[model samples]
Target: MSDRKNILFIMCDQLRYDYLSCAGHKTLQTPNIDALAARGVRFSNTYVQSPICGPSRMSFYTGRYVSSHGATGNFVPLRVGEHNIGDHLKPLGMRPVLVGKTHMIADQEGMKRLGIDPTSEIGVHHAQAGFEPYERDDGIHPDLVLKPGVKYNEYLKERGYDGHKNPWHWAANATEGAEAPRSGFFNDVANQPARVTDEESETPYMTRRAMQFLAEDDGETPWLLHLSYIKPHWPYIAPAPYHDMYGPSDVQPVHRSEVECEDPNPLAKLYQERISARTFSNDERREATIPAYMGLIKQIDDQLGILFKFMEERGQLDNTMIVFTSDHGDYFGDHWMGDKDFFHNPAVKVPLIIADPDPAFDATRGTVNDRFVEAIDIVPTFIERAGGTVPEHIIDGRSLMPLLRGEDVAWRDYVISEYDYFMQPFSPKTGRVPLECRTYMIANSEWKYIHAPGYSPMLFDLTNDPDEFVDLGRDPKFEDARKTMHYALADWSLQYRQRETVSEERAGQMVGLEDKFGVLIGYWDENDIEPPAQMPDYASGLENG
Candidate 1:
């Protein structure tokens, strides 16, 4: 009875798609990501084309658009020869097993737009793409984290921290240096049960390495795993019963009313004296503060209830294919924001639960798909469910497996969120942060759109303001729905970044001339992927116009 479905792919870094209680997110418990969204198919308008974190997981594993994988900025690097989805499902025999973190870095200009042969660049960037890294680390950096272990930094040094003031180039502050690293946030081990061996958790070391990789392997073979966590992404540290799980009178505050944020785009201003709401506030700071982000979303919902109770005690929970989402999201204090580079909808609308334990999609079990998917349709929905064939010249994402077989699939009406800062940092010399050509969005099923570069269009009609707190891009009776959504946000930013080739002859004008005329030509020196040793004369003079 092997319908061939093994693919776990759970990710939760900076998780936010309304912190799951089936996404309305009132208090945040996550009951195992709401029981894996009652057995899969959640997508209440998903997103993440790019908000951050390795260019939104590299435009979600090459469904493309980080400006067609130039990875369009953010510490730059990644360019390796395209074909990922674990090099296109390891050629149909399926085995893309990652089991944690797939931010996928690729250098050498992503290996010269992947024609392949900086050697053969496989997995994690195998020594400049020749292929070998099932795991590699090139001086791992994110201001380098993975801290806490002096009995958890001496339990954040008996707690009253003072860690990051004299120039914390971002990240530092969990009461600054130690203590609040929150080791078991004071785990009183009594009537025993909290035990996942809580050593100040990172979702019990990523669900004990995904339950020792789905209980000693055979998670139904045809794999694609991904895992990636760092905790509700922050030094918001949570250890004991999720560092207290919520109190300040059942914490839910921080939706912004004061400390400024009526922002109808006075260029959506920032740096309001370095924002706050530290471990979140508003409900008279009662301290359980959304129970330390719902104890780090129930410590990743108890490592997704230890990988769905080890896939229902290894019967392999009806054939596998989980998905639970998150790559970007976590503003916690909404408007008076704190994290996530901005383009709200609680920071790029996440939470996408997929679950599919098939009987050819058993009535999409427990069903909830409000359609509108996009994370570049998750690598052509894992290369058309591994039987493979999404190769529209390497990918632009498209297969939600025909809306996961409920069929009527039309999709892609709108869903794009992009922002840039080039891995955000540097100001002292005003060195970085340029190329501020930004974009923020939301579309009609009630409108939102934020738009940037000396901002202005802030619209929001999410039907009587679904908590986008009115700005209707500045009313005047919706001035013809703000000039019809400013030419429908310039036709949804030019038909989702339109370009679809034209060339009968305009190759960036004669391959953009090299040192011209007398030409000392310093570059255009094809270092490898050969063929054009000399095709020069189209009426010579290195052809311009």
Candidate 2:
């Protein structure tokens, strides 16, 4: 067998860092995820580049920040030419295969302008965010209105389920006997058991399909399989046993202060008044959906157990590296917020565990790294594991290999996160909130700073206010500290984006008929010579090696 390492990159959608037992949640126990952490390294503080889906995952796949890649929101496409994890690893003889959702929209305008066919191999890769899809189910079934009948829908229909009524909802999102025509709202069907069996739900289906892919894999080349799960996100319903596994008592009390609702950041106050948080804040709604959310997580943990056992039995575990993390966390009504957007710990922080099987990392096995890490670092880590050099100009992250190998290394002193709330349909109608669209956060172990355009900045001394309940942006006592953080943000903002740097150089170095610059084609023979319209073809006379 080849000595090349395989990567099982697993990502859970909307999973919070504190939800896992290893991350210090007292109630929720993720044995399978905990097992991975116990066998490897757990990064206690990891932040996503963006708080939302598309931009966050784009940063993850491209190893660049949201500003760098320019996929600033959900449904926004990563630019066609951007190098992603697949683009980087495939050249190293590793197949980057995707088994689940990427949430990447195709750059339709770019493709059309470039005359690229969406049905072609390269076109399909760009459409799926640069990875070849083994199964591309983004998990928002009803949202696939553009293309009727998605793969998951067809899968449900094939199994005698009613696809006419949107079986994805019937089988995965809705509970048994919850009104024949239930609205596709979590508040309507929350905490109920799905009509389908647990094994037939989306979580188990994804797991089984992943295992099937492994069974059929040729195993001739090293591969990076991205097993992305889109559960524990919403619709807050689980199948059969998992649905009934938890209750309202299991739901942790909402973490917030009444004072937080008063004199809040303009955006935070606006978010609290929005439908997302308001809907989740109702006492009954929280009781109904939060438990279901926990159940969904439990189902994921159980499925992970199955996948890990299969890997061990197939002897793939010893040669494979397992990475578990999420794009971002759900607020869960923390700080009077529901969905992820603000810089609160529950919204920005995510769990990251990397289990390297290489003997060099044995010393760091079962260790925890508290230094702040970002989602961008994932691509670089994968490249390093695949024995490839990361493209520094394109990738904006450092490798964790040295830490994994138990070597002391100098790391970044702070981490940054960004969010753009302008696109959200629900805006501040009262006009009390500023029209600021962008929010940037620069944080270290001691202080967290938030800056929004045209609004009062917010600052929290994390050493004292770990939950970030108090904002000191206007406090005179914190003027010096806030100023220091502002400098960090300024430094971070000044870094070069360099999006077209390589493209421009490549264009300049290539001429009409050969790999030669027009000015340099005969520079040695004649200092300044115009190149021929069409260089003489030389391939025909070149001897075969």
Candidate 3:
């Protein structure tokens, strides 16, 4: 056997769980992810620690909750002295190399790759962190028009394009060819894709880099590489073959109702526009849904094919522990949301496929582990697979090594997912609304217990109401059930989640404090704040006795 095993962590930007072929998807052929899942374990209810990009990515790297990491949103970095998996693996003689997008950090470094000036305020926080982020060469996102498989701009230009244009439109129109030439990704020519490819987009590049690392014997040392992709996420454009991979009618139908506004979460209404790409008629959705969605997934799978083939050819298929997952899930038109950050099924559930490298440990493969798993589990699992140690300080995730070894143990009775409702507070941020009453969910196989601060809570009997159209939390018949799950959310929070404690007087001092420090939004309230107790990390403690 090799002295140590390699870890191939393939992360997609915002892929949902149900989109993969291994998990009951019929129309989309994700042979690559499928092949990996066929040889490993797939979790039916895997979740993201946080729903948004920045916070979720922070949890993966730190293995801590947003409460602990103090990075509850985008635009902030895990504070200095904070431990990260990369920093953790460094001592173990393992180098944690990041090959692609890390939406976790912005600001301090310029967005040189995207060509945005650091001084332009386009980036989130790294620039605020005091590093002169690489200023954009010309100020534009490179991939706007530069997809992998098919070259778009030249094709459009060849077709006699005039200006910029977005090919994706309600009218089935291109944004540029007529008056705009579809507005290249570059303000001038940036967003325009010179090429588009199914697998070529994000997953392929990430896999290629990782495969190169995996194929390298590199003496007796093992490698831990995080292949992060920005695609299958947003600006949802899949390159051809994939772009034309499937018929629109063949796609899975989206969740839409005449009464979308009746959901009453208020959050449901507040973030309506931010979540979905656009409102589509039933007929429009039928024609547009499957083709683009399945095509992107198929593209992601194509890369998986390459990565798996590389592993198999190199004799490392069964010798390496491969973890396949995403930062979070996409809405996919579920609950009228298109992106993530919402706690709906399509937006919250991501695929977690782990393959044990040892034959003796391979029993866990080909089985569905339906436990409530989260992205945080990755680090502990990786640390153990390499025969290294799992650090107590940085990791909140339990190692899957026990499950892999067939130990008779349960992982988590429930999983917690958090979201910030700064956009629409039931009250107001003026110390009047209570920071929009953070929403937390404690979910098990039978139900989902959601606790939103100012608004009435939500409880979905996922077993029965999988669409989550019903509110079981408020139902008197399920009072006991609601209490049971609510307690779980509360109890779990008391155990792991933490946030700043600021009194009214102390809060006033922080009004203009933006001049000095970063913001870490709190998911907890006064009633929720019981501490044994170190104060909030904020200097000059917000709450004075």
Top lDDT hit? 2
| Top TM-score model | 2
CA-lDDT, candidates in order? 0.59, 0.82, 0.62
Rank by TM-score, descending? 2, 3, 1
TM of each candidate vs. truth: 0.31, 0.90, 0.74
Candidate 3 segments exceeding 4 Å error: 106-176, 179-203, 211-217, 256-263, 273-286, 423-434, 496-545
Task: List CA RMSD, all candidates.
Answer: 22.8, 5.7, 11.4
Model 1: how far residue 15 lies from native, Å: 2.4
In candidate 3, what are the lDDT values of residues 127-156, reduced to their tens digit? 322211121111113445533322223333
Error of 1 at 69 (Å): 23
Per-residue lDDT for 440-522 in model 1, tens only?
56565767666654456777777886767566666577777767666776765564333334232444554534433324344
Instruction: Give per-residue CA lDDT, model 2, range 1-545, as digits (tens).
Output: 34868999999999998899888877888999999999999999899998888899999999998989988888777888788887889889898888888899889899999988999988887888778899888887664473574777787878888745578876667665635735335565776678778877898899998998888767678888999998888777787788768888888888887778768877678888778788767767777777778888989999999999998888889889999999999987788778887788888899999998888889999999988799999999989998987667678888888888988899999998988887765544434343357889999989999998867899998988887899898889999999999999999999976754564445555435342322235445443434443323355432211
Alpha-carbon deviation at 508 in model 2, angstroms: 18
Model 2, residue 439: C-alpha shift (Å)? 1.3
User: What is the Å distance of residue 508 in model 3 from its true position?
Assistant: 41
